[model samples]
Target: MGSSVDAVVAPRGVVDLRGEAGAEFVAAYPADAVVVVSGLPGAGKSTLLRRWSGAARVRTVDPRTVHEACEAVMPAALPYAVYRPWARLEHFRLLRSSVRRGGPLLVHDCGSRAWMRRWLAREAARRGRELHLVLLDVGAATALDGQRARGRHAKARVFARHRRGLERLLAAFTRHVRSGGPLPTPEASSVLLLDAVSRSRARSVEFGAENATR
Candidate 1:
């Protein structure tokens, strides 16, 4: 009976060994690493990752999918909205195994609050992996201009979401820079901040500049 138990548990021990030594063994198994790209709408997060494709980029449609999933589970508007944030948490967990294996960045396009970004940083630190942020510091005026120039299909639900999201991004930016937090810097890892106003015709002209290098 003791021999049988040992045989049954030996495989689990090997699995634990693989999991604990993930940093080294990840190379053999091909794990996925996600680099969250966040900014206000028209900040070019999508364009950046799309232009420079190497690893697999996974997307999280928290705003839309999470809402739908919530309705399915709860069948009430209040609970759906209230528990939406928790539902999005699943994305982080899904990336854990992939992160250990280390593959392509899971590009997160949604505009997350600054505090949320800090939380994500903590998660990255605990996992022994690096967290990089690409902050496209386009001013509100510029963002508004970009939005106005957008095609009919590109218009989002309302101006409120952008306004609120912008406020959050700016506040987060201030906290990120001055708070002495783990926010990525050029020397630490890589935090690239591009000024959109410095370039014109942002869609093709200015955006093209970065693409040219790629």
Candidate 2:
């Protein structure tokens, strides 16, 4: 195991990256911390991870990647819904295994499941790491356009449900940022809130500053 950790590190609440102009945001964390990237469907989570300019010193866990791999082997006429459960199960298994490895991680989530985050927090804490969050705040129209661009679409009701989950998470972070109270996230150390501009302008998410050069 790595060195022991006492508590969540500095930058303990929300770091809102929305209003800053001109500078690209570079997120820094401990060498093996867990960073979760969350937003609504089509919020560019996958694209952002793919666009990392620096050498990747972290492992990324993307559900879309899992789904696509499964889709490729699936029968053409079978809708994704038919095998959705299996894909989700695979994703969970992969994420769990990845988390257990105890290296830096970048995860993609929709902010829809409190239990998932809670479990992640527990696991990270057990491993002497902290869970960080990166949230992309975007409008419904923009998300839909993203889906169309990628040839994937979330049903209206499903999108609405995701939106609600995001709203709740955002609200919790908002309160955390404003009041400096207990974090809604179990054992989560920090969160970075980003709007479309900031999200587009972000340069990279680095595990540790040393990785940027390596």
Candidate 3:
């Protein structure tokens, strides 16, 4: 059985990825904890997690490739995006099962809304696994800048929708944090809110540390 937790009351403000956000995030973590990075679509969540835990130690719950491979098996009525969260469900189940059988420290790269985070915490608690959340805070301009800087895709094609999506993501993040629940640690000694644009070395150290832990 799982335990229910009370909601969190957060301070209000424009929490840009400046110095303050990093301090706030780090203060919420405990020592020797596996960090879960949360942020907007283009908010560098994956980059931060990879840098903090090293790509090798970072186990993602993203089954997008798998879903794509077995696309024919999926319902034709549902779109590709609709299958995203469903695929994540499989990955989460896989992670839970693997941990039971003694697997590596997996860092999930998905949109963990506050409610979802609470659910995950409950599940982890039931299985005696620790959970930590690291929220990536970036401004609209910063997100737009990051999108414009991307070379992997045609930015011109999705820039408009991407920005709108980011806006919704940020609002969701705010709600999640405000309605926060208990963490594995009472309070974290070190929490990293990385500015993906600058400070690559520090980010690499965070990743190195996580990989070393695993």
Candidate 4:
């Protein structure tokens, strides 16, 4: 861990890491900062979150875990889509509860839901904590490879939706930065963009008072 993002610090803005290589990122911020790890369906958002959560010793509101718990008690023949609504509700509830308690929370988001992003950013602001984005910008082909690698294939339509959402999001962020307009979303003070290479290169994400969680 040799580099810092300075994401929510002075002159707060986007901290792009797409081109960085050979540097293990140590994303440091306030102990209370809320970070949203976002990307397409196969962009490895959950994987990165799992790694960072262990390293940062931070609690995360991940819907996948909720799905797993729900799956454990349900009939084996039933598809996850049948109970997705309940899972979503449970995830939302957990996220709200976690945010209320507050202090260096990491959220796994697919970047496909604008409303969720807005809500997260607002909730963080309400708690006097900054909301930052750590987006994995790996493109479509690579993302699809990731899905196959994980053996979790997102439906085609859903994957397309996520891709489009991510494209629009990145475009909006670019325009905002170029025009010096408002942030991409509510209460989002900074965004850190990373690609597959950079994400892998990042060893850990540390939150306040730096401890070697590895």
Best by TM-score: 4
Better of 1 and 4 by lDDT: 4
lDDT of model 2, residue 64: 83
Candidate 3 — which pairs collide?
26-191, 29-188, 30-188, 52-206, 52-207, 53-207
For each candidate, C-alpha RMSD in Å? 16.4, 6.3, 10.5, 4.0
In what order do the candidates fall by lDDT, top score first? 4, 2, 3, 1
Q: Estimate, for each residue in 1-214, the C-alpha lDDT of model 3 and write its tens digit.
A: 0122111111112223334221112122222234455554566654555554553453454333456654777878878677767766666676566545433343544433445556555655665555655445566566556556764332454545545653565555455456754322232222333355332323332222221210
Q: Mind giving the per-residue lDDT tens digits that candidate 4 earns over 42-87?
A: 8989888888898878998888889999999999999988998998
Order of models, best TM-score first:
4, 2, 3, 1
- lDDT scores for all predictions? 0.42, 0.77, 0.45, 0.80
Q: After superposition, how far is residue 2 of candidate 3 from its true place, in Å?
A: 42
What lDDT would candidate 2 get against the real structure? 0.77
Model 2: worst 10 consecutive residues (lDDT sum)? 1-10
Question: Candidate 1 at 108: error in angstroms?
Answer: 2.1
lDDT for model 4 comes to 0.80
State the number of backbone clashes in model 3.
6
lDDT of candidate model 3 versus the reference: 0.45
Q: List clashing residue pairs in candidate 1.
A: 31-101, 31-102, 31-103, 32-98, 32-103, 33-103, 34-106
lDDT of 2 by residue, 40-114 (tens): 899888788776523464688989889999999999999999999999999999998998898788898997788
- Give each model a TM-score: 0.46, 0.85, 0.52, 0.87
Which lDDT value does model 4 have at 77? 100
